[model samples]
Target: MSLKLGIHTGPQDLSMEELLRVWRRADEAGFHWASVWDHFYANPLNLREDPCFEGVASMAALAGATSNMRVGCLVFCALFRNPSLLAKAAVTIDHLSGGRAEIGIGAGWFEEEFREFGYDFPPLGQRFEQLEETLQIVRSLWRDPVTNFEGKYYRLPGAVGSPKPLNPNMRLWVGGNGPRRTPRLAAQYADGYNVPYQPPEVIRERLDALEQACERLGRDPAEIGTSVNLRFHMRAHAGDSDADPPDNYVPGSITGTAQQAIDRIGEYVETGVGGLNIAFRPPINWDAYEAFIEDVLPVFHTASA
Candidate 1:
């Protein structure tokens, strides 16, 4: 499939109604999907970020608001909830949105959120172990008749499903960057992989690793979706700053000119990205929304390998 373009929204905002306007505008702009961040506190992207709203709540609200839009979390913090319960919650949202939900999840990182919220922030290895179990349990729970799972981290006794996915299998997207475990989990359960704001070179390495994992597992890497989360826009000096992004941000994250920005995305596409999720932090900077919607996005859509 050719590349698709989408944007991210912060859940640490005022209310769903407030963010709903952004979603409606994105929908009106002819975008394919709307992704919201699932951070409990302000994330690394925020220059001086603060946690605003809850992730799943905004997801449920977004699912209810838009009819044509496909809504999902950019990457949910998976450590806070039980896998079976999280699966049920996703299933409920899927039913509410009439099957428009896609589960976007990751092994939780943000240490601040865990310490502040009183959740265990385990060592990296243990977290990956939990994430693996979570993905497995979610897949099992989505079965037509329901199933059982007894893993080191999760134990569901003949768990009955909540709302069976309308799509024979609910779409799963695992997000992260563990050279070994992450891609293996993706190969086993993910319909797609959601990568964070890593540089193209790093992204290429990660993709290679995933391909290796897929090969080991007898999976065709091409069959699994690959989506990159472009950290920030590169419109110009005076572009949107709804988000005060960081400097170490990747090349795609807020440094290039319009043409350069387009070129960078093209490079990523060439490197095997199936879709691009460009970040549009607002306050509407020097860059005009008209120019972006009218000029830039169209160029991205028509861009070919």
Candidate 2:
């Protein structure tokens, strides 16, 4: 199967102008997808309190701006908006993008953001329950003529989300790697599963779990696409003056020179990952982005073609 490549941008510390420039460039460069993260705060640990943009709103703007690249939030917190309303928003953005919209969602993490937003930070299990309900509600609103759902966390009485998504197969992506509920949930509900911030070994384990989930659910494993999200850091050469990696750099990021990035990404592809969502660390690293576009993307694109 062909590999799908995408750029994932964190909404923190970037102006709309910068975000547009990067995404538009990726679109013009023929990247398959472009994503923005959903967050009210800059980062979980950033004490500097950098500027952060709202995810869905940014996705709407991104949808309108890009012509070819698919636009979506990397993963919206399911608790951040009402399920039915989120369905409506997704539909709107899908129309704006002429059917190039993806819905990426996860159970809300980052407890502080929830508290500050006046949302209850419930236990993980309870949050998963909410996530499950949100998935069902959103899917129903998108596909069903009328939806009437009553769940522990959400309720919809004759909810009719209008102007349905332009794409009949609007992609619903579930992000995260919870050992039990998450994999099963994705098998049952999501069109795609994306595990972030993990190495190849961990990703292999999660994919195994996802396959098992699909088996238990009596669904075709091929029905659910698999992808990974990795942080990226690169430079023109090994000892270039501006080659220092980002301070927030964690282990397992796809880092190094152009050839190294090509090899590292290939490892995941070998493990049956069909897609990659890469977030480059600040200061945006156009040098790395340019190199990746020139040297790395073509390897996969040509293989696919």
Candidate 3:
């Protein structure tokens, strides 16, 4: 199946005018969507000292500014806002996009983002539990004109969220790779799954686990969207211990030529992934990204077409 190709909204500080300029280019370039990392920190991947940018709000700005590119968070943090409130915000952005928003979400992970912001950094298991509840509550808030849910962690005696999504079906993509709990949870609630940061072998293992989760739950893994995060670092080879990858050092992010990256996307497509949201190289690497878009995306687009 043909799928969307996109970029992450991290790296570099863009002025309001600059952000609009780049976003217009993204749309004009035929990218299917765009996304940004959710954080309150200044320098997670670099030492730029660019101030904090809220993700969902930026997404709304992008949605309003871009005519066709679907706007969304790379993965919105589950703990950052009340579940229902977040859902309402998403619906509003969806309206702005004319029904082209992807509601990607995940359990909060950055300790600094949490501790520094007065938010609790619950342990992973507990965080996952809260994430599960967050999904249920958010979806309910979107689907039900009014909802009353009383869970151990969240309570909504009366939940009224509207104006509902413009499209009859809204998409919710979840990001995670925990072999035990996350896949099953995605099967239960998420419309899509973002492959977590891992090596190719680890990705295969996680896909197997996701397949098993689907089988046990009587869900079709095919119906659940398949996606991955890719890094665009043309310099670092697989064996470079000294090479500092610009973004997350997820396995497979280190090094590749533009052609290698396209071939890798082919490999991912062969393994059933439907979309790839690439974290391009930093400001200095924009030339690399431009080369990639010119050389890689077209081949994949034509092949998959």
Candidate 4:
């Protein structure tokens, strides 16, 4: 399979105009996908004063700004919105992007955001239950003419979702770093599975688990796409030895020279992921990003071709 390259930008610590510029640049540079993240607060939770845009609105802006690449949010927190509302929003975004919108959902983790925002921060198990219920409701709403779901957390009775997605096969993704339940959930419900900020070994293990889950469920493993998200911190030039990634940099980050970035991406391809998204946080290294668009992307695109 051809490996797709993408950019995953968190909608925090950046202006709307800057975000749109990045998205438009990725689109023009032939990226296959572009995605935003969902969070009520800027991650690492350093301060409450940080500027963070909401996910759904940012996604709508992304759809309006980009013409080529697919637009999506990496994962919308299931606890924040009703399933019916999310489903309708996804369909509307699909229409806005002319059938280039995908959606991902997950059990949320930001407890501070939940509590501070007046949302009940349930235990992990309960959150997972809610997430599963949300998945079922969203699928039914998108596929079935009328959705009627009776779950412990949510009840949808005879809900009709009009103006179905512009793309009949618009993908729904399940994203997390969990090993067992996440894979099982993806096998049962999602069209795609995504793991973020994970090393190659961990990603391979997760993918293997997903395959096993698919086998146990008697479903085709190939039916669900797999992807990994890595932190991007590329150096501007090949000789910039001192310009290393931060000491506290997360695992699976792409750093160093253009050639090194290419090789690291190759390792992910070997893990059997169909796509890789480099997560961009501010202040973005524009020079490194341009070098990636100019030097690194072509190598993979040409090889895939």
Candidate 5:
């Protein structure tokens, strides 16, 4: 399948009405997917540190608001909630959206959220251990009639979650850049692998690693999909030159005019990325989103066609 695009609004700064507007607009514009992040605090520093809505609740709202676009959290922290409960929540959202919900999970990062919320900010290895267990439990809870899991970090004894997902084939996206454990987890338990803010070259290397991990598991590399999420900046002026991208540009950012953005996306496609999830640092750039959909997205659709 050709590449698809997703929008990440990140549940920050925007009021509830504005958030709803953005998701509805993306859905109406025929974007393939939309996501909000799982965070207790606003991510961008400039935003007035106001009330940030919880991730899953925001996704539930998005699912209720949009009919066509798939909506979910982008890489919810495993440490934030009980794994089985998380799975149940996803199933509920899926039913709400008529099977348009997905889950993107990762080992918890962002120490600030952890400490403030009183979640255990365990060591890296322990966190990965929890994440692996979480993935396994979530998959089992979604698929099995009665799930039983025993792990160091989490345990399930004769656990059964009813109202299985509306879509039996719901997707689980794994997000992380762990050179070893992350890719292996994606190979073993995920439908999709996603990396945030990594440039095309960095993404290519991760994809290579994932392929190798898949091969080791005797799984076809094609079985797993890959996507990159990055901060995006579109140079708005028509007179903007197609000059070389700045050397000091942020690591996982795409910044350029329409054609330049297209070329950058093309580089990612050439590297075998199956989707691109675009996020903007606040103040939210609705114009860039609209302009890209108008001017750049069609070029990709045409090329793929």
Candidate 6:
């Protein structure tokens, strides 16, 4: 499959109008996918007062705003909402986008959000249990006519998920960078797998684990699409204040000149990932973003074609 280019952004510290503009611009610029992160507060969690939009609602607006790109959240914390409810929301967004919607679920890590929001911050292993049950429930609801499931974290009795997704092949993604269990769970349950902010070598290692997991499960590794999300810190010009990345800068970010950014993305492509998403944080650099659309995207898209 050809490599797909996408955008991932959080709905924090930006107005709804600005967010829609970004998504619409991505659509017009020929991005293959556009996604939002599921978080109650702005990530890297500097302040509790920062305005952040809810994920499900943001996803619906994303579907309504963009016509071409597949819209998604990567991902929703499994413990935050009932699995069945989240599945229904995904189906609704799929229809809203004319059958272009995907949803990703993960065992959430942001403990501050959990504790402050009054959610029980259980141990990691237990959270993964919730995640596993959530995936089973969601998949059944989306694909089955009548769903009946009984798991440790949740139970559904003869439930019907009406008005199934507009597209039967609508994807469900598993997102995380966990070395073992994440990939295994993804091989068993997800149509796609995503790891965010990891360098190419780390990504390659994770993909290898995924392949091994698929082999052990007697499944084809090709069954799951894979992607990585790179932080976007490209510079528009020499003097741009935000040109310098933060002190706690993530490795494998897309930074520097357009050519340099292209080179960085090439490294990820060489790892055999099917897609790469440039993650945008608020206080966006419009010039830098446009430079990417004009100078960088064409290089990879042309190569893929």
Model 4 off-target regions past 4 Å?
241-243, 302-305
Candidate 6 C-alpha error for residue 85, in Å: 0.4
* Runs off by more than 4 Å, candidate 3: 1-3, 11-18, 43-49, 235-249, 302-305
Q: List model 1 lDDT by residue over 94-160, tens digit each.
A: 8898887887779888887788778888998898888888888888888747677878887888888
lDDT: the better of candidates 3 and 4:
4
Q: Tell me the tens digit of each residue's lDDT in model 4 across 1-305.
A: 35889999999989998999899999989988999989999987778999999999999999999998888999999999998899999999999999999999999999999999999999999999999999999888888899888899889778998888988888999999999989999999999999999999999999999999999999998999888999998898978764487764898899998989988998898999989998987788888999999988887652211
CA lDDT for candidate 4: 0.90
Tens-digit lDDT track of model 6 for 95-170: 9999999999999999999999999999999999999999999898889999999988798999998889998878
- How do all models score by TM-score? 0.88, 0.95, 0.88, 0.97, 0.93, 0.96
What's the lDDT for candidate 3? 0.73
194-229, model 3: which lDDT tens digit per residue? 875465666677677788989998998888876777
What is residue 250's positional error in candidate 6, in angstroms? 0.2
TM-score quality measure for candidate 2: 0.95
> In model 5, what lDDT does residue 20 have?
87
Stronger candidate by TM-score (2 vs 6): 6
Better of 3 and 5 by TM-score: 5
RMSD to the hidden true structure, all candidates = 3.5, 1.8, 3.7, 1.7, 2.9, 1.9
Top lDDT hit: 6
Candidate 1 TM-score, true structure as reference = 0.88
Error of 5 at 18 (Å): 1.6
Once superposed on the true structure, which residue ranges of model 5 sit more than 4 Å away at CA?
44-48, 239-249, 302-305
Backbone clash tally (model 2): 0
lDDT leaderboard ranking: 6, 4, 2, 5, 1, 3
TM match of model 3 to true structure:
0.88
